[model samples]
Target chain A: GDQVKQSPSALSLQEGTNSALRCNFSIATTTVQWFLQNPRGSLMNLFYLVPGTKENGRLKSTFNSKESYSTLHIRDAQLEDSGTYFCAAEAPQGGRALIFGTGTTVSVSP
Target chain B: EAAVTQSPRNKVAVTGGKVTLSCNQTNNHNNMYWYRQDTGHGLRLIHYSYGAGSTEKGDIPDGYKASRPSQENFSLILELATPSQTSVYFCASGESQSQNTLYFGAGTRLSVL
Candidate 1:
């Protein structure tokens, strides 16, 4: 079974628009991490959360451990934001590794 | 910034041949991990290590073996490559206290035929 699942497998946004990505976890998680895999195939860490919300520039993320879900919001989408967004969950009781979601591919056009 | 470097950006191997993917991190983190990225299955953990000389099987470790000979280096080994194992492999490193925040390498693309 997939412990982590992402919604809206693919998305297209126009420049200056805003969109959100969601992740649902079937397993108990204590923390969550969001990543962006750029066009060059490099995975960059976007945000790390502990059952709360954190904002970084045009990107904001929330992790609700109680409900076993997380969300990432993209504001003022840019061409550089076109990439694959993935959310990973940390279940302390499971192991030291984080469980990852299938990911949402975002394509922001100008 | 944390830096993780993986060797052989791309590799092609024949079935039954041995293949090795290497990763080195400069952050001196205590935890290192190897994962494969497939089309529909974002990323699946293959192996991980807590520190030097320690390796643990991850979610899908049947055809993979990992080695952590030092704090900065981790290696994934495939003794007998198969076509089904063709995928992009990524290596990550993170501190023990914040293992969830991982720093990944560019990734190594492996193709087996």
Candidate 2:
């Protein structure tokens, strides 16, 4: 089984709509981070959460260690949101390194 | 925000050739990591460094070697590049040894012909 499994391996969204992506972890996690890889190949950090929810602009993320899952929500999706999203987690045992998911490719169309 | 950069955004190599991916961070971070992304495998750790002159094996370090000569620079080398070794490589920097934050580079796409 994968330590981290991301849902909606691929998604096609209509511009201005809202959507949510999820990540489930088999390993016990202490912290989680969300990233958006743009078309230019640059990965932009979205949110880094401990256990609660954090909102940045039109994006909101939550990490539930108890449930072993994390969610990334994008509101008013735009054309620029068309890229891959990854959720990485750090376990409690100590290790700065992260384990990433397969990623969710999103394409927002007009 | 901290900055982590990778050189040669794109590369193409032949089978059995040598390929080196370079990364540099100006944030003076203590931890640096290299990850490769594939179609179904996501991003797997290939190598990581705690500091200058120190490197450690990662989940997928079979055909890869890593080097850390300075605090800001870390390199991943493929001495014998194969088609299977071709993937999008990412470099990241973090501030702590344990429970820290990470910043990533743009990424390096290597294609083995």
Candidate 3:
């Protein structure tokens, strides 16, 4: 079974608009991390959460371990924000590795 | 900034050939991991290590092996490459704690013919 599920397989938004990505986990996860795979194919870490909310400039994220879900909110989207967003969760049963979601492909156009 | 570098950004191998992908991290993190990315499957863990001389299998470890001889280096090996194994491989390093953030490499694109 798929332990992690991501929403909105794909999305497109205007440069100045806002959007949110989500992930649902069936496993008992201890932590969650969000990553942005840029146009160059580089996976850049965006946030690491522990059942709380975190904000980084125009990006914000929240994790609810009890509910087994996480969300990433992007504000004032820019052209540079066009990329694939992935969420990974760490669980004791899953070992030291983090289980990842299928990811959401986001396109922020002018 | 944490730096994780992977060697051979791109590779091409024939069927049944051996392939080795190397990763080096300057962060000196205790945990290192290898994952593969396919078109529909975002990322799947293959192998990981907790420290030097300790390697563990992840969700999808069959037909693959991992080596962690030192704190800064980890390698993923494919003894008999297959076309199905062709994908973008990424290496990452993080602190031992689950809450710690992970730093990833640019990834290596491998093509097995």
Candidate 4:
């Protein structure tokens, strides 16, 4: 079973629009991290949350430990926002390794 | 920034051939992990190590092998590559569970033809 399930396997957004990506966890996760795999396939950490919200530039993320879910919101999306978004969770009871999602591919065009 | 780099960013090998992917991290991390990503499986853990000279099996470790010869380097080896083994492999390093923020490498794309 997947520990983290990402929603809307794929999405397309127009420039200047906004969209949100969600992840629902089945495992008892304590922390969640959102990452962006850019065009070159280089991954960049967007947010690391523990039952809270954090915003950076045009990106924001929230993690709910009780509900076992996390969300990444993209505001004022741009062409550079087109990439694959992944959510990974870390459980307190287990190893330090993260369980990653299948990923949500986003294409932001003009 | 914590720098993690993977060598041989792209590889092409024939079936039954041996291939090795290497990762290096500048951050003195206590844990290192190897994962493979496919269209269906997302990212499945193959192997991990707590520190130098230690390796542990992960969710999927049958077809792969991992070695952590030193604190800064970890390698994933495919002794007998198969077509099904073609995927993007990523390496991540973390300090510990409490401060377990992973620093990921650029990833290695392997194709077993």
Tens-digit per-residue lDDT, B1-113, candidate 1: 99999999999999999999999999988989999999999999999998999998888999899999999999999999999999999999888875458999999999999
Q: In model 3, which regions exceed 4 Å deviation?
A: none
lDDT (Cα, tens digit) per residue for candidate 1, span A5-35: 9988999999999999999999887889999
| Candidate number with the higher DockQ (2 or 3) | 3
Instruction: Label model 3 with its docking quality class.
Output: medium
Comparing 1 with 2 on lDDT, the higher-scoring candidate is 1
DockQ of 2: 0.62
- How would you encode candidate 2's per-residue C-alpha lDDT over A14-106 as one tens digit per residue? 999999999999998788988888888788888888999999888999999899899999999999889999998873333378888889999
Predicted candidate 2 versus true structure: per-residue lDDT over B1-113, tens digit per residue = 89998998999999999999999999999999999988888788988988999998888889999999999999999998999887899999998754477899989999998
> Chain B TM-score for each model?
0.97, 0.96, 0.97, 0.97
Interface Cα RMSD in Å, per prediction: 1.8, 1.9, 1.7, 1.5
Tens-digit per-residue lDDT, A1-110, candidate 3: 27889999999999999999999999898789999999899999999888899999999999999999999999999999999999988856434578899999999999
Deviating ranges (above 4 Å) for candidate 4? A91-94
Sort by DockQ, best first.
3, 1, 4, 2
Q: Each prediction's Cα lDDT score?
A: 0.92, 0.89, 0.92, 0.89
* TM-score of each model, paired residue for residue: 0.97, 0.93, 0.97, 0.95
